[model samples]
Target: MQHNLGVIGLGHWFGWLEKGVGEKGSLKLVKAVGTKPFEDKAKLLTGFGITKDRYYISDPDGKIPEEFFEGLDLVHISDPNKFHKAQAIESLEYGKRVIVEKTLAINEREFEEMKSFLKKKGMEDRIYLHLHYLHKQPTLALAREMPGLVAKYGKITSIEANFFEPVNEEDPRRTWLLAPENGGIFMDWVHTSEIIFRMTKCSFGGIKKASDFGVNTDYDSVNPTGVETVVEVSGSSYENGALATMRMAKGTEKALANKTLRIVFKSGFSVFACFPGHEAEFNNAGARGTLKILDAKGKEISSESLSGQNSSEIFISEILDFCDGKRVGLNLDEITEIFKSQWEYQRTAGTRRLITDRESIDAFLRNGASYTYCK
Candidate 1:
């Protein structure tokens, strides 16, 4: 009953190690492919049940060796966004299930190609996106309440969601994240967009007033080497006729750190969710801060404190369910629509200078931006 797994990237080894690795767990890592040397990754791979002989360096041409997929029941592709389409389609050709990281492709064309291939093979359920944020406690709680809230208070009317993480100069992700081929800050919003979709079950309508900082002052330079250190976008949703605004940024200071979602209903009822890292202080344990129901007068109706949980632990459990043909994650059509919205924003969004100085920072704060929990 063991499901053999092969990994296409090593950036997440530390997190993946926590997933049950051997006979005690359902997933067994049979092969590992990465850009790093075998010696550097062998110890970590061994911990994940990958034998030394099974570790292979990816080809310089970026082609996955055909033999690597010979025995894998599924492949976990955590490579950069630009590499997802080729790797995913290739894995599917070998009849292995695929779990890819978010921002599934760098552009709409690539996203659609993956979808078309899946349909042609009739393996639509064989691929899943590793949008781990969806597994966070507050998100799960909000998802549970969405149905009842809509039935009682009517459809959602407005939404404001943002995720800001401090940029670590030494962080390895910064390199590729800034690469033009990977689709810049616009691609990073896939997580935020998917969250909006899941919570409201609405398709993104189109981009309106989208902008990014840190790339360039030239508004036409939507795809550039200097990816957005900060991005903010507002748009509409199809089904519920809601105005949704989302912001995502990696800032150099703690002043820009937060993760929250606010949903307002037609009846003046709202749900405010403080996700992990809502505070400037980050923690290892993924304790989602709180979920509060607020009235139009801003009085708290009910609040739930979600306990600390490991994200990887939740991901592995849900992904296993996905491997069993369960529809626990976003479907291909939803992914296609999300990417379409991203493309529209990229083509139309204006580029602004990076917000680094005190004057700009103060101006940003004064523009009615608040990250604190419902008070």
Candidate 2:
């Protein structure tokens, strides 16, 4: 069955989705709604033979024409962070299955609104969050090997993850990313956070304590918003009693680019590294990296370079299953827990607070207080 897709954003990432579908032959690009006329420049449309008639530039008022929504089996929402909830809700209300990009919303209030609407309309099964990183080679390898590693090494005691991207102040591509309103490091780090959640089996136990700090010393002139060019987050997870820390940065020399995940168990440790690029890199034939596991005495237990499998390919395959009724969308409870922990961090940005219970987390989210740096 070929599911017709309506894409809400025409950014570079959309190209990966289009290419993945093209390769699988299980989906079709019927129409696209974006703020600009991206058809001419989008290699996916031209390369895949998607006709020009399928692209529709959104109205100046920012409304997508109602007609464009017709006959779409799936709507892929990859617009800016602020628009995610509304776009996903609208797509679901129109009876279209939706795959929304990560950071489902910029904050908890928006997430709750979308969650409530989905429940009210009984449309939970129709939506999925595009956490494609989970399907990446390194992540999949970790999941497949973690149980044995933990058993052999004892309990996981600490984790360190970092994703750094080089930024050019003159590059138009980063305009939205440099604005806090659109979500700076907070929005971009969702991938890293979800990776952590999965790696730990959602055992973070609600973020016992968290602290965040942001600095915009790099491109403050062009980014009047003073959005953080660098962000640092550290916290303790309740369940495993593990200390977790993450560092994300936007402005850096290309030579210094880095994306790495390291976890230390009671008796051993493992490290995974990949380039700092789109999730599609995991799918590229040339995309390869190393996973190194060491025992307590620093003796290498296993070390291997992984490559060949594409994360986008895996993601597209899973998406096809969802379309064919073989698999349900992302688990709502899992998503809720992730967002809850995210909100806790945002609520206490730059400070540390031990979130004692679910009720306390709920109160913080209900208050709808904006994260100071993000606001």
Candidate 3:
């Protein structure tokens, strides 16, 4: 059965989601609501059966129209961070299954409201949080093999994950992110904490904001003060003694392309997983990720490229299963744990200094920096 999909915000990711709907996929894109008309982009989407009439401009208030949800079986919320809770609740109120982007909500109050509203509607299983990283390989493969790896090695002692993106001078998304009300970089990159929680089953004890490197002056002339572009966070596992560190950056010319997760064990061995390039993954190609087992001395003992579906396909598959009435994706309990961890981090760290000078930007990018693919 083809499940109709209505998109609340046609931002950068919806294009990739469109690709995930392969010729015979179960989902279909019928109606969409964006802040603007998106003229040039509409030409491309018409091939997928979406016409000009299908694209509706959002109201200034950000409430989606009832007519838009009338015939939809599911709704995808890709709006700005602040709008997630309202749009998600509206979708549920209309009896539409929902797939939302990360950070569930900006704060605990909003999250609880969403939780309460969904439960009231009795559509808890109809919602899913699209944490694409969880579906990516070496993520899935490593998570599946964690127990065996722990048995062979010892218990995990620490985990380090890093995600960095080269600055795009022309990308308007960077400008949109500068508004403090938009949730800034912390809400965007909190998924790193989720990755840690999923693997260790430990909530973050406390998150310390190590540094915040905002956009460079020359790159973003509009906001000279800039918003957070790069940040380093360290936290210990709540239950287990394991430690986790994450560094996330965006909109910096000095930044390099890096996405990886490294898990170290007590027995003097570690496993490092490297994800595929973003373009390949978004293209719906069978992007392959690699996992390398290294000895304590950093000697590579074994390595293999694990092949699997990209995040887009994996997310679509899960949502389709959900539409079929099978329980999948994160449950309310899992969502609560992840949301609480993220909220604690945001409350404790807040926002740090805005790095405007070249010296500090270089310093923040020094450790855990990668140059494999520069932009």
Candidate 4:
């Protein structure tokens, strides 16, 4: 497998990509790209000993950026929305593969353009890294296992989901997510709906009706259906001690959201998913999986799984798949399904505005919302 990689941005996300390479078991960061000044770039790579030779040539002219794709088989696009269009097409044009980060494009149009370009370039084989959820082993496992469970437990009855973020005023990306154009909460957090849609194996969990909760009013089209689920979201982060909640559902106490990840099952079971550190608030430091069930006396039965794998090292598993030229176990089709479901939900959802104050929020939770998307 090729160890070479080109980074299009040096912001927070690229740091995540690099941090994972060593643990990825089969990947090496041979090359990387960033627009930081020479001294700054040197400082950033000082520990890695990455030299000028490995530094990607800036696409000042957008002409393949000499040696940009030199030894690498994949280009990790971490650039802002405006650049994904050109960066993705150009990376494919150079015959290098692409591993685009979340919310791959600014909108449907840009995403479509990249898809069309891939078809034009005949580089579909080179595409990798869809939404993060599709890579979740348990979710995929559950999605696969749900049919049997439903066959035994019966069809899902009702679902209430929350997938919103509380953005910090000092942060750029969080603020960016507040806006509608760049996907904001609706687009970023829409994955919650997608995952439920996928797992239940119903198209939008029968999505019948919905109500708004905060400034997050992206939902407006949901209506009563036998198989649908309705959801709401609210958020803010105008101050520090800031936090966010990625997901919460019915019967769960409303807590100040801080990268919280939990799911409740009708099997009288509950699962909490802990992702690796991306921030002080969001980082669980390592992977920890917990299972909870109500005992006969109403006591809770619980178990947990800790990963020996590092967050970044996980990507190498997929790289090995590419090396073997087989699709293997990656969650490509699952994410595709989630994306489709999300498109439908967004087209037909509603929203509400919640009154927020620092005191009120801290009395429970600071503002925290996750941008995690569905397949």
Q: Provide TM-scores for the models.
A: 0.83, 0.81, 0.87, 0.67
Worst ten-residue run, lDDT, model 3? 224-233
List the pairs of residues colliding in candidate 1. Answer: none
Which is the winner by TM-score between candidate 1 and candidate 2? 1
The TM-score of predicted model 2 comes to: 0.81
Residue 158, model 1, lDDT: 79
* Per-prediction backbone clash count: 0, 1, 0, 39
For residue 197, give model 3's deviation from the true position in Å: 2.7
- Quality of model 3 by C-alpha lDDT: 0.69
Per-residue CA lDDT of model 3 for 134-244, tens digit only, reads 777767787688778888887777777767666664455446664545566666466676676566555555553455565444444433222222222233322155666
Off by over 4 Å in 2: 38-48, 168-172, 205-240, 271-276, 279-286, 297-301, 350-375
By TM-score, the best candidate is 3
Q: What is the C-alpha lDDT of each candidate?
A: 0.66, 0.63, 0.69, 0.47
Task: Kindly list the per-residue Cα lDDT of model 2 for residues 1-375, writing each as its tens digit.
Answer: 788888888776687787687777668877888786664557755665656776777665446778879888988988777778877877877888889888667777778888888788887778888875777777777767777776766666776666655555443444665465555556666666677676556544445444333223444433322112122223322224566665555554554446677777776554444532564374457665567776566566676778766777788888888787665545888787555555665655545323334464333322222211111
Q: Residue by residue across 1-375, what tens digits does model 4's lDDT show?
A: 445666777766777666666565456666767655556778777555567767764555334466667777767776654566677778777777677766555556566676676668666677665454544443454466555644543334333334333333333333343344454344445455445544554432223343223332222112110012243221120111212223321111223233334444334333333332234312454443322333323355554454444334455577666645666332434444445534544455435334233353333222223312111
